[model samples]
Target: MGSNVDNALFFLVSTLFKLAIWVLILRVALQLVRADFFNPVSQLVWRLTQPVVGPLSGIVPRYRQWDLAGVLVLYVLAVLYIYAVFAILDYRVGLLPALWLGLLSLITMTLMLLTFSIFVQAILSWLGPGVNNRAGSVLWSLNEPLLSRIRRIVPMVSGIDLSPLVAILLLQVFYYLVPLHPVLR
Candidate 1:
């Protein structure tokens, strides 16, 4: 009975920690896209996450309007959360394994976000120019820099947008081929 209670508490805390990390990521992504940070949704996320990020921001400082400190703090939180969850579940995670898994999760999240943006862009284009979809706008804001660079390099083949395909392929390579820290292997 006590064990069950302990497990329940562990699960609850782990889930909340994970949710907090995701909320922080969403806040950063919103900032990246120039979303109204003061909107109810954004403000709620900021409020939930700032308690953790606020102090870290002071330590690392901001650069070029980019929140490298926030990203680093999120990464550290993710690693610590993973470690705690494993410890609570009685699983051993060596340093290398933890680092590799954390990196893998980060890469996966980034690729998923990129793929989602590409899918949104494709759908918006199909819906034609007049439809003003906010999702499309957000996707464009997130993806435009990467896609623009690709466009300059790749050019449009037969008037098709190959940038998305290229981006997906690159993401796939990172997902599968990259050798993680040796300790993980």
Candidate 2:
């Protein structure tokens, strides 16, 4: 009974922390992609993250399109989340190891976000065809830069834009190419 209760508690804590870490990551990525602030999804993400990020903004400067403060806060939160999970699980890891794992988690989360954004954007494109509604706009904001770069390089095949395909493919390749062993060791 005690072991079961402990396991349940571990799961609850870990899930909550993981969700928080994901939101923080989204806060950073949306800024990195320059997602439209007025979009409902963008506004929701900002509202969720603003409290944590607002306090750190003065300390960490923004670089061009990227919000450096948000990124830093995400990193701090990721590391803390990992540490908390380890503690809750009653598993011990050295400080350096925990930090490295946290970094690996961050990278994985970023790639996941990119892949998800691209996939959703692709679906939205297909569903609405030529519509430029707020949902489409939000998706475009998240996907446009990377897709535009891919479009430039890949070219349209017979006037059918294949940039989304290429972008998703490239993101998948990067996701699989990310090394996890280094962080684990």
Candidate 3:
């Protein structure tokens, strides 16, 4: 396999795996926020993930509103993604290291996704404030938990809610500040 082919393969696999991982994160966050299950967006997430999460849901017990099955599936996908990346890059790493790297990658990706969701939510609000759309609704639901807490701490001034901005900054700091090079490396 040439370097170009390996790069292409890595890109393809990374995109597909990351897409699934993002959906799983949304699924878990949706449940955590108690988002409207009947919303079209919510239904789409459920249907898209059912084939993979349904079986795991049966095997993994739930804790309150937490989606343990979704979490398990996410971790497995993360590990598989890491393994695929290693193979594609021809890195001869050990299994345990891969497992640890997978965990780190998962957490990093999740935080990155959160930052993205908040950013998009802000855009949606700017584009159409008070718009009644399923996607926007889900986006708001995903963002409210974080924004609400921030809002409490940082009061709105002149009717401008600064929570989203503050939230994004905080999330950015946390994710970037966390050292990615684990003991395995």
Best by lDDT: 3
Candidate 1 on 53-119: residue-level lDDT in tens?
8888888877766677678877887678768767776778999878777766555555655766677
Please give the CA lDDT of all the candidate structures: 0.70, 0.78, 0.85
- Regarding lDDT, does 2 or 3 come out ahead? 3
Off by over 4 Å in 3: 181-185
Clashes of each: 0, 0, 0
Off by over 4 Å in 1: 1-22, 29-48, 55-59, 95-97, 128-130, 179-185
Lowest lDDT 10-residue stretch of candidate 1? 176-185
- Candidate 1 backbone overlaps, count: 0
Flag clash pairs in model 3: none
Ranking of all predicted structures according to lDDT, beginning with the best and ending with the worst: 3, 2, 1
Cα lDDT, model 2, residue 65 = 78
TM-score, candidate 1, is 0.67
Candidate 2 lDDT at 103 equals 91
Clashing pairs for predicted structure model 2, backbone only: none
